[model samples]
Target chain A: MPETFDSPPRFDTVLIANRGEIATRIQKACRELGLKTVVVYSEADRQAPYGKTADSALCIGPSSAAKSYLNKDALLLAARLTGAGAIHPGYGFLSENAAFADAVEKAGLAFIGPSASSIEAMGDKISAKRAMIAAGVPCVPGPDTALSDDPAAVERLALEIGYPVIIKAAGGGGGRGMRVVPEAGLLQEAVALTREEARQAFGSPSLYMEKFLQHPRHIEIQVLCDTHGNAVWLGHRDCSMQRRHQKVVEEAPAPGISPDVIRPVGRACVEACRQIGYQGVGTFEFLYEDGAFYFIEMNTRLQVEHPVTEMTSGIDIVQAQIKVAQGDPLELAQADVKCEGHAFECRINAENPDTFLPSAGVITSLALPEGMGIRVDTHIHAGYKVPPYYDSLIAKLIVHAPTRAEAMARMREALAGTRVDGISTNIPFLRALFEDSAFTRGETDIHYLEQWLKQRRAP
Target chain B: MSAIDFSDPATIAFLTEALTAAGASGLEISWPGGRLRIVIATGNEAGVDVSVTPRPAPTAQPLVVVKAPMAGHFYPGSPSRQAATDRLPSVLAADILGFLRVGPLLLPLCAGRAGILTKQLAEPDALVGFGDPLFEIEPQS
Candidate 1:
């Protein structure tokens, strides 16, 4: 077989096959790198600020994501019509899609992320855990093999792994198609229920088992690799401030975890990247509990929380990813990389503050916070419609300072400065959360945010 | 005083019934400087909203529908602009204007009607769907 990482790619244009904040973010990166960008938007995003700013913007389909952002064929067709040399999935829609990545490469276009094989490897939790273990990365204890139909085998494995195990579908992610078993008595029923749910949700019956850890924090290491045999870990992030398993707030250099503790694991992630010949940017998500790291999965695309890492390290991750796709070698070694400051990213979603239900309407007025060390990544403007058909995230308000306390203070000020009118926003909720004593202390875990909300809501 | 949420099934059904009651199989919803014409498909039993307009939002420029000759990736230019202009502006009726490379074969796509090429609607080296626009032409009378 030919060497996968051969010659460098030569391209000056990229098609952004996404909408909202990430689309604008990718376009800015492309422009800074002297690359032209073509933006493909749905009808709902007709008046989006990013579309007008792009070199070329085209309407792909209707507002429904199925016809617009997730329409693989339409996106590819848009790329073809626009003369884009490559396509940037931009974190959502088709970002983690293995088949879409394969199709892009097969159609003689560069996929601005990891190879299809790498994506496929990480797509399945079972295969990903096994790979991570092989690469000497710490993982939650569980049977590595795929689940069998035999009841005896399932029960034996569950007993061996101990109680409170989680039965997860191979194709599951984003807290879907999983069941937690507290005891052996409920094991079979949980497995059977999860299998049916998996078949309906992810179209896959393949299931995997893992030792469920309570109160584990969601930490992730950011890695950037090139076509050449070079990789660098860009430090860690704590996305534990989540509601309903969806991240609402993220911060770089996860609070309280010393560099000495995370460094080795980060190095292991870099080694795994090189071992797999991974290209572009990828994130290794881990569950941190009892001062130990357990690999969960790898996001083979630019993460939404990338800005927090960028703010702390002063590294333009999107630009770096684009450069890697352009066949650039690693400019700096592991030693050259150093995180200087603390950074936080608050996802400003267009949703109800109470129920968290998506609130869609025209943003009649928008007053975005702006100042030194504060960055707002968004595609929304005054009069921009917050469509109900897609993710509720409207913008990412990021702030960086010398210390975590300073960063938090800066975030509070920034949050106060933000004002979105004619539509409900979660700004009020974020403001309260920032003022909370536990959140300010940075001792919260994955379930902390939900629990906090419940406590606040208690009559 | 209120805007309609088109995605709601109730709104869609109401709109369909309203249109049918008005003795119009087709209805055009117009906002300030924008228009959306919904036509009832010929054979669709339930009057499916499949016939949606292909407008690129509201712009000041006069709308000109650019029709694609064949399905392929839209490429605005071949090698260079000089090359594109030389081949495009001087092409006769029978001449091969440009090629749309579908996989391996370079299929020849022609300028069916004589006109001044106002704009190249598609991007260079882009994959185009069947009947998707490639170029905008100002027809010579």
Candidate 2:
């Protein structure tokens, strides 16, 4: 049943402030909602299929991301020019930028995500930890405050938290602006270097310390919330396959974890959202080790690896986010949420299989998998030019099956059927990873991919 | 050679804006006694600045297609004047060829150099995006 909304729809048209596959994803959702779509692109993405098919496509700036996708003023101006009443900032770029969200709301446009205050609350690592603890979310053992400048005091704090602590920037994410110290000797130097880096990179030298888990597996809970204080936890995901803190592959209902162990954590994440008055979709990322979950951070936007959860949980997260932005109450309760089958998502990047350098060129030929349980979300086609200006993720290959082993087999088949010509891709690397005995047995840690790559490189 | 007064503050301003919009690393022109360069710095989100001893012209010329610096509504001329909007194929001299309106702001679209405006690619009052070709110009050789 559709809940009543007292106000008229907040937006009749949505301006997609993103590019590539995610932009294509959002446009499809808007089409289903019967809302007019406006897609913005950088000059390099002039030939993007989403832009071509959108109700109105506009190039917001030049090829440089800073001048285009990251340019907040340009995005707002584009929305105004196109008479778009809302803007959906897909993952990456300015998706989590609190200032952009505030500016969007100030411009009388829906931002299609949480309010600026909620984003700010979760953006700061220390504040986020405090919020999580308040909501009964388990966090890594550490103080919920910024580190002091006093060297002696800092050393004492480190001693209290024990060595092997990680120093992180308050305003940083995507695995940058952090330093992991394995012992006391390197603590001060690491702190100094990281603080300076944080100041230079994130515009603030404020740093915090936490116990660095040595063998934690990356896990996260997907959550959806409405403005009416109703929220639901969709399910959990295992994104342990990482290279340099970037998730290369992800799966749903993380293998081998009992539902009893994760259910409380999922409930806590939903509680955190409600406590902060969160709206729209978000991900509560964690580091799990020894059957325990530690809250890390909350990505206050739609995640790149959301498809695996969508396949298992059977929800159109992007469309739900839009509906929540339009002031609609959540249509489903926690009881309606169900994780049916296992799923896997491999991020197909346009890069060298070994060196991982970005490969940008026109696709001379293309072949992607088809058939039941195999879905490839991509915006590329034959003759499509992979732009060198942005993230190298060109496509996502997702497969679902009733069991994890069957899903692995399905993914292997899909990967075998895939072919991209005229440019290098990580297809070879993904195929090789799928065959790894440890990965196949679902017994890999967050550091497993790097260790695997290191072993592969050893003579 | 052409009489492009690179020293004119208006020309420098126009060139800097154009360089930033085009994502050009920088622009350098040299002639008899002077030289001018406008660099669009990669850091700090494309901050463009030019220090000029400004005097001069060109070694070569090519057709230039002026595109929008950012997204906005494209106007062929001062909208208040009815006849100016329809006038096309006119000769331009490093001057304002059109205007791009964003709300109350009307950003002048300059040609950057002397040329014959051969075509207007965008419709009057049309919402044009960045890098949308607005005018085609054949520069004087």
Best by TM-score: 2
Worst 10 residues of 1 chain A by lDDT: A1-10
Candidate 1 stretches greater than 4 Å from native: A1-3, B1-141
Per residue, candidate 1 scores C-alpha lDDT tens digits across A134-180 of 77889999977789899999999988998899999999998888899
Q: Poorest 10 consecutive residues of model 2 chain A by lDDT?
A: A1-10
lDDT of 1 at B37: 55
| CAPRI-style docking class of model 1 based on DockQ | incorrect
Q: After superposition, how far is residue B129 of candidate 1 from its true place, in Å?
A: 10
For all candidates, what are the clash counts? 10, 0
Tens digits of per-residue lDDT, candidate 2, A38-111, equal 99998899999998889999998889999999999989988988999999999999999999999998898999
lDDT of 2: 0.90
**How do all models score by TM-score?**
0.79, 0.87
lDDT at A164, model 2:
88
Error of 2 at A25 (Å): 0.3
